[model samples]
Target: MTQNLGGILLIRMTSLGDIILTLPAIRAIRQHFPLHRVTMLTSLEYIDLVSEIPYLDEIITLDRRGKEPAETIRVVRQLRQKKFDLVIDLHGKFRTRLLSGLSGGRQRIGSRRDIYPPNTHAIDDHFQLLSTIGIQANDKSLEFYVTEANQCFAQELLNEKLLLGDQVKVGIFPGARWDYKCWPADRFAEVADRIGKQYNAAILLFGGPAEADLVSQVRDSMQADPILFDTNLQIGQLAALISFCDQFVSNDTGPTHIAVALGIPTIVLFGATNHLKFGPLDPMHTVIRHGNSLDRSKGNDMMRLITTDEVWKIAEGKLNSLDK
Candidate 1:
């Protein structure tokens, strides 16, 4: 097949949730240009997760969090060498802006300009970029490729923790990157206990090393015994574990997005964030918002306004539906 374009470099050097949400549009771009190799320029920690994106031909990683000067120069130099045909900046941040300029692609597309479109989801923001180039982004589902090895690892960890039963495995992620976005850990524990007792389900706490303290807060507060997923599993393995969840309840965070992509009935607790823009893609999934919208300045206390009972009802409804 004669290639229409040399290659495409997609820049999305953001944190977990945003990066995961960008997948569908990225996939659309790859599908639009089947013959061209689609590459993603992302953070080093995200390399494993992005690698699972079958549509992407290659992944370029950088330590964006650490701000490594030499690494940036090396990556930038290599990107210039690749002589990309198109560069898409989904992050729309300063670093991605710089990369978009240095990419040397014939056409450079970015998600945002001076202001965003009046009302749109964050995912659509990426799709809007494709429209400019006459490509309609028809696919809007989140994508995550889980390997057999990763699945096996997840099962083994579950078994080791004695969570390999027919009982429902409710995965809970209590921490979000930002304080404003995180619901209280104690409330999550209360929800876990309610679900565990009401349905005879096993609570599964999912988080990283950084989230261990937060995880502890939830676990210790809970009356129910939860299988703590605080191990050093690779990003792929962690997602694989999430796949086993019957229903996931979480703060507005990356793992919540992962659970939603896996087709799990996920209930997201939203307060500081806008539910209209960042809520679940599917109607089947739930997002319990505060009575009113709040800004970051409103503080995390607003999240507490989202009652445990209200979220419990939504979660129980999902679990009951699963039984039916």
Candidate 2:
């Protein structure tokens, strides 16, 4: 709670969406401690993603997948050398907790999920941690900074694909990290076809290399020809491309949160997950859940329960609202 605190180290190791959700809190920390040296410790895979965020003074990334023991020791030594005055562990995992303890910070704070009610949004949960340090984060808005160069990259790709113009662009991401969280690909194609026919929107299919087959399935099943973006793109490139979309449709995945952070109008499909906790909180975004209850045991069946008509109706409403 002291204003004269030295270096502050914040840790959130892995997973893109979770890291994206923590941005508001990070911004709040920067605002609260403008004079202090604030550094973020994240996984190496997300360095490209977190690097663009202007809130942190420094970023330290670890190759979490490669060289396990050696990387851990190296990171521990690095943290100790920095001699952080305060260590805030946004990630409550054992590894982060251990690092926080070994960082030699005089004050240490870890996230306490029990302090808040069930189904609290991750952003609010993070703010609750900040409250412990007398840092009140009243403005909890997610942010992703896309540099002009990356924006130019996205524009060039759109121009090369002849996807430029005033026509509405709809981005469809038909892949989820978990199988149970994905709606059927055929259903996505049907929705894309309907949107293309009704709104005459340019369909932009997006996916990582791992989801190329899934993205292809949706594109192949669609009657309309969609611009494919299935190649491996850097996080900034992906965010820049997504920024061009007028409307985005995606499963429960990291890119969904990225779209939300970029202020795009997004429709997220959720299954076997707590939409209340992780779904977009802004009014511009829509979340369509499969069932009345949160039942992880239902598995992929929960996602299948979501009909094409259901999603189409919401998408129609959103597109119509855009006209107003």
Candidate 3:
């Protein structure tokens, strides 16, 4: 049914990685309906990240911390003011469920649980939300657009370091919010040391302030010299740096999604979390899983398992085979 075109609202109040992964759907929506005003509901922290993305006409921030009913009601009221014709509930949470239900939108799309076998993959499951609107799924790749300004900024940084032309830069993301997802800092350092020595590539460590200690630990453990970018880099700078990277090795984090979306070859380490549901969807990316090191102490699930050697081999293979 060709519903009368009007404003579209997308509800995906997830972490940075999940939001990054949703860019394909955003692009598809924008391309499909060029004139429609497309808005997104996401975390307040990610406002800058979504701002750099071109397709969004408006972005509504929902601070998930202190998630009071009043805050949700305020969001609902704001959404009501927007007068969206369709609300695509990518989050499918109770909050989004309520907001979409009460926002007065004509079509409210959401996900179904049984579409794929358990742990199939998140992108596929996320696409299920599209099905509610009669939108058939296809093999659409993830999307990320790096503006020329960001690229210039990245290049300037590289140039200042005198490491610009013909040098391969690799990104390592040692931080995943979940402990099950993070490979050991020592293991990451070992792999980085080996790869850097073998390929003469500069390894740039990426993480946020919370992971500053982990970054320091990895840097201290590394035998090969590396550039530690552990401090908080804005989403644009991070995107720009990832674009410049010849390849990226990361845990199942947002930067991994960003790397894949930017068309960079990435090696992702997955544990605890279901790889089938959340694995990277790009051909240029490969996922390595080991025994579940994730335990309650680590702030991750205990059932999952993966080893360091397995991830090292995968990272080695992907980095070695990277297209120049």
Candidate 4:
């Protein structure tokens, strides 16, 4: 197959976790087409996060917030002007597929659910899409690049909070997009307390603006005072702050994927979602699912089934390994 020298445009818009999962495939694409201009089209909100990634030649953002229809047409026009040889839609949603079809690329590729089953891990699903173009992806590892400025910002924030030290730092993200996806706030507080007392670790609670109330609830419930980080941080800044942690604990949320990408030993609690499909595949991370079966109908009840002791045990093991 002859490789096209013309530009390549990749589309993946919205959701932090899904965007993060696409890194491995993007890296593979970059490796295969080193000379070709590789551009990524993602959501405007994730510009900071995507900018940190070193894989692509350029990044295009679409703000599909209030006026999605008008915004989509404007983006489609912009994409047409780019005159890409190949367009790959990493996000297989209706909007992304429409963008790929209308982007005026000579060749466009979208998700191949037939090649890779729905049960397959998201990272592998992305690789399956690349297979259609004869691009064999060997490295399935996720990557998240942290900038020096973000690192300095993280350090300064920690210093201000008196959290800069060699002491073990455990980052806890207690909020998820959906309530059913989140483990109980009190349970998280209990686990954080145990980790803090047992390891004398600094507990850092992280969340977005929307999760501020939930984060505060967890902090209030905790026996120990934790550093609150719900100040609407950009994704890159959040990644830098997470990098400072020795261990990360979270519900089935986007930041869990961020921690995994950063190679931080993470313990993620899963319920109502299939752990095999969405959970971290890295050996360094541990996934604690609610039960053997996935019953979304049960709602957050499934999340509640995962006891504090169950998660604490796994967290303790990972922290112990880190100590060694």
Q: Which ten residues in a row have the lowest lDDT in candidate 4?
A: 290-299
lDDT of 2 by residue, 2-26 (tens): 7889999999997889999899899
- Model 1 agreement with the true structure over 1-324: per-residue lDDT tens digits: 224778889998867778888888877877778888888899898888887888888999888666788888989898999999888898888878988898788878887745676457877777777788777887788877899999998888889888756879899988887888888888899999999999889888877657888888988999877888754668788899999889999988888888888888899888777776777779889988766655687748778788888998899888989863
On lDDT, the candidate that comes out on top is 2
Reference-based lDDT, residue 90, model 4: 92
Task: List TM-score per model, in order.
Answer: 0.94, 0.97, 0.88, 0.96
Compared with the true structure, model 3 gives a TM-score of 0.88
**Local accuracy of candidate 4 as per-residue lDDT tens digits, 201-249:** 9999998769989998998999999988855998888999999999999
Assess candidate 4 and give its lDDT: 0.88
Considering lDDT, which of the candidate structures 3 and 4 is the better prediction for this target? 4
| Cα lDDT for residue 51, candidate 2 | 89
Q: What is the lDDT, from 0 to 100, of the residue 233 in candidate 3?
A: 80
Tell me which of candidates 1 and 3 scores higher on TM-score. 1
lDDT of 2: 0.89
In model 2, which regions exceed 4 Å deviation?
292-295
Worst 10 residues of 2 by lDDT: 290-299
CA lDDT, candidate 1, residue 204: 84
User: Given candidate 1, what's the lDDT at residue 46?
Assistant: 81
Order the candidate numbers by TM-score, best to worst. 2, 4, 1, 3
Q: Please give the distance, in angstroms, between residue 211's alpha carbon in candidate 1 and its true position after superposition.
A: 1.9
